[model samples]
Target: MTNERRVLVHPDADALVAAVSARFLTKLTDLLDEHHEANVVLTGGTLGEAVQKAVATSPMRSAIDWTRVHFWWGDERFVPKDDPDRNEVQAREALLQHLPTAEDHIHPFPASDEIEDIDAAAEAYAQELRDHADPALRLPVPRFDITFLGVGPDGHIASLFPEHGVTRDGQDLVVSDEDSPKPPPRRLSLTLPVINSSQRIWMVLAGTEKASALGLALAGASPEEVPVAGAEGRLRTVFFIDGDAASHVPADLIASQY
Candidate 1:
């Protein structure tokens, strides 16, 4: 793990989405070139959905074989599969449905109706990851080429909220949350350890509400106090933020274009 961190600030939310979408396409293309297939973990939020929409509308959308690209979500609301609030549902409506990806390649967490117990659903997803992992990859989770995340206003990543017991929990690759701080308390999420295993991580931020959290995490705040501080890619960690979100970050830490 190189553990390199880069902070990129865009002019605004729209430019941020465009830049991220372009990079997403290029990253997938590069990974597919080196391997038979590529794996990417998706996030859910306003910026996340915007990025997906950008991808769907990008001219380079067809550059890679969508069938060989496996999609997984970092976390999902424990709602019915068809619920508009479900991350999987939002992703499909935003982009996945337009792609040629096979049903088998889209790994969405089980919904409430699919499994009676949230813990059971989380375990099942972990098993699914183990089954898909190639022995040569030697990872608890699949060797993700890129993992996407959205930092919450409170500095949480995925469903691992700051100071939550789950943030320090290392036992499960996927954890179940029945009491999330946000509404729709139920959720299933890949733990910080599991997310950090990815080769590359992209944390996308858009609005000013996230600026304080982003600033704190990038400045060496304790992960236990700010869960977003805990997640870093094995090779490369990137913060793709719009100016509003990057406003609170130190001028020196920002890569360029203030």
Candidate 2:
């Protein structure tokens, strides 16, 4: 069964970063303790990098056996591996490289330089998911303990843009977007189904510019019109926003504690 969505508003961007970082550490430890292994799907953006950097400096970061954890990307720009625009590049500089995480355990999408094209790269990632799928998940993916997503002001999540029909239909675990409304044009992203398959989905957003998108998502907007609205987790779904982003969110939807 799917779970209802919840909203958590932080005082500001800085508070959002600290709160999320702390919550991440706690969730990681809990998942590791309960399952012995944890798979995390990470996002990329200024905020995403900020959270990673915060986790790197966190006092509780060392408590976990990083080797037991597997890190995955929710989506990636199809760029050269060494390109500064690549999410993995910023992520490594911010956190993953600092952890003792096993090299084989970090699953980044195939870079443009490493593969033929976006389609090939997308399939490569899909195969990687299949390779890591747990039998019990009953899906062609791993047991994603937590999937972190950064919502665009336009309400897109991952590379699933609302402008295109990218969020509409696909059983493929991963899909390639060759003409993204945003930069770089090409990208690879996990489908909404794959994202929703996770145990928990954390949608992180900030800034007053995101207020409309947040309000629409919570107002039951169609996925095709607001992709973020369609994203949910089997166990839990949460919208973690800052005061600025929550400007249009209803008072009742805002949880004082989560």
Candidate 3:
């Protein structure tokens, strides 16, 4: 774990998406060159869709054997599988559906109807993560090659809202938020510890609304107060932000070269 952090600023959201999508494919290609399999965690939102759509359309999408790459989500809404609000649904429509990935390789958290409750859904996903972990290492969760995330205007990452108990919780690999600050309250999310376990954490931010949140995260605010601040990847932490979102970023914190 190098624990290196980088801030990449793009001129606009479109550019940010393009850059990220290309890097996503290129990095996956590099990882596949070194390993037989790789694990990638996805995110949900307009930004997520943009990135997925970019990757889906790019010719570079074929750079790696999609079947060998396992897809997981950092967080998911506690809704039915087909619900428009579900992260898995959006991801499938924008990208996964187009890829030749194996059915078992795409891991989506249990839907509301598929499970009795959010707690059960969290446990189910936790078990799923454990199932894919290296038995010899005895890990509770598999090592994520890359985990993509989005930060809320309020500085929340995934469903771990600011000041929420889930943000402060460290015991669980996966946690539920029944009272999220944002609408559509119910959600299941990987905890900060689990997120930090990833080899690379790519945080995509867009719009002026994210300016303050990015500042607080870069300022090192407490995770309970700004959960986005807690997302430090084992090897690298990257903030792929548009100029609007980068407005509040300190000059020194910005990485001159990626």
- Model 2 TM-score is 0.97
Which ten residues in a row are the worst by lDDT in model 2? 163-172
- Ordered from best to worst TM-score, the candidate numbers read 2, 3, 1
Q: lDDT per prediction?
A: 0.89, 0.91, 0.90
Candidate order (lDDT) = 2, 3, 1
Candidate 2 differs from the real structure by a C-alpha RMSD in angstroms, to one decimal, of: 1.1
**RMSD after CA superposition, every candidate:** 1.6, 1.1, 1.4
Tens digit of per-residue lDDT, candidate 1, span 1-258:
368898999999899999999999998898899999999999999989999999999999989899899999999999987899999999999999999999999999999999989999999999999988756543667889899999999999988888776454455789988998887999999987788888999999878999999988988888888888888898889999988898788888888631
Off by over 4 Å in 2: none
Residue lDDT tens for model 2, 136-250? 8757899999999999989999988996765545678998988899998898989988998899999888999999998998999998889998888989898989999988999
TM-score pick, better of 1 and 2: 2
Better of 1 and 3 by lDDT: 3
Clashing pairs in 1: none
Model 1 earns a TM-score of 0.96
Worst 10 residues of 1 by lDDT: 163-172
Best by TM-score: 2
